[model samples]
Target: MAPPQPKAVAKPAAAPAGGVQKAKLGKPRNYDLGNGVVRFSKTKMFHKKAKYKFVGKKNPKAEKAKKPTVVVKQIGGEKNGGTRTVLLRRRRSFYPTQDKITPRPHHKTFSKHVRRIRPNLTPGTVCILLAGRHAGKRVVLVGVLPSGLLLVTGPFVFNSCPLRRVPQRYVIGTSTSVDLGDFQLPAHLDDGYFKKNKKSAKRTVKRKTGEDIFATKKEKYVPSEQRKADQKLVDEAVIKAIGKRADKKTLRGYLKAAFGLRSSQFPHRLRF
Candidate 1:
């Protein structure tokens, strides 16, 4: 009909002054404003600008500020029932004085009543055996035990004292003391140290000999006879160094005089 009148064409809406067109929903409005709550826009094109900018925004609820504590002080004889005013001060830090600090319950306590008796014998001191099979024998003190006992040795020369422990009371201290100038013996050496060294020396010799025959094979051997022989040699050397050519009777007499023992205390017959 009449060449079909063209339909009127509608023009698109003009954009706003700031070059950003208004949202079809309306101006971006915050439903929750004063409560500090933020709601994101559901539309893909909406991007709301923040009202206030902060370099580093920290949450107030995340870390609570600590309140300062108050301390009270009273002056002018408050405990004596005097009229005194109380003063309040903020306590930043506390440091206790010596009088205010309590002592530890497990602190070590000292007592004058506690007594410790030391042994009369000392190393290099010559002493006479008063009891046991080696009684009336001359022996040199080698070590002192924590139990107040004495370790004596004759070096297997004077009276066959073989590194034995004797009670302090059973042995009499003598005035004749040997000077240990070059001879060094530890004050607290155990009996097993000497025996073990002697055994090791003997075993080392046998190991050297076996190593020559079988270079690849290993052997664990201990020769008891050789150990005894080595120990005897060591004892003899020690004895010769201590007193050369001194007879057993002469040593006994010298020790007896050092101990100031009377003739009645002497043994009736020499056992060995």
Candidate 2:
């Protein structure tokens, strides 16, 4: 039993001393493969992805050499899928025909239902014209716009209602707000200043002189002298803000009265 007393071989493990925690490669560190020569290697071809014990265990041949030959394929293999398409490089239609375009929407879809504006439609508010071509008239609201649209005006020399742009849910707001003291509005009354030219200089001059564009004569809408000098500077600044309002004859008799509804009127019990 005295012959088994010569076995004591436990030595290595003392190489970790440099910064930021990455020092594990402990043993087999020497190589000189000049022509894979027989010198003294010890790494079986360097590191051989070296490991000592649980070097971060797990290996079915390193998980089959780390997978990914481009796969995300689960279209018809549908295991709970709605959109996981990774066609990933199967090349071969190198432009022999269909170059494709016009598909659309990868972006631009705004105006999300935004037509809000009428909290008593402000800016000098008088409002009444409910639906177009001056329905039941009374205009005034002067300018709100940024796409919410109100800008009204009957200041077309009293009641013809010219400086347009309607939709504050088709106007109506009334407890008559007017004052407009220092006036302001005209920075070119925008909404592209009531944008009209939908290309009709008499149907483009009768389509460039070939005439008889439906026997001419219907091109009527003639307002421009810069739209009569911007409706005479917005009707002389709304007659100087209704002549310093002392209810200026009930605001010109509520814009020449005609907004009907008299059978004991009840537009939601009309407060305005």
Best candidate, lDDT:
2
Give the local distance difference test score of model 1: 0.58
Residue-by-residue lDDT tens digits, candidate 1, 61-176: 66678654544444455456444444355245845455566666774444323433344566777778878888877777766655455777775644556767787778767665
* RMSD in angstroms between candidate 1 and the native structure over all alpha carbons: 28.9
For candidate 2, the 10 contiguous residues with the lowest summed lDDT are 199-208
Error of 2 at 47 (Å): 18
Question: How do the predictions measure up, each by TM-score?
Answer: 0.34, 0.28
Model 1 scores a TM of: 0.34
lDDT of 2 by residue, 108-161 (tens): 345444666757777888878867667998878877767777777777767777
Give me the displacement of residue 240 in model 2, in angstroms: 19
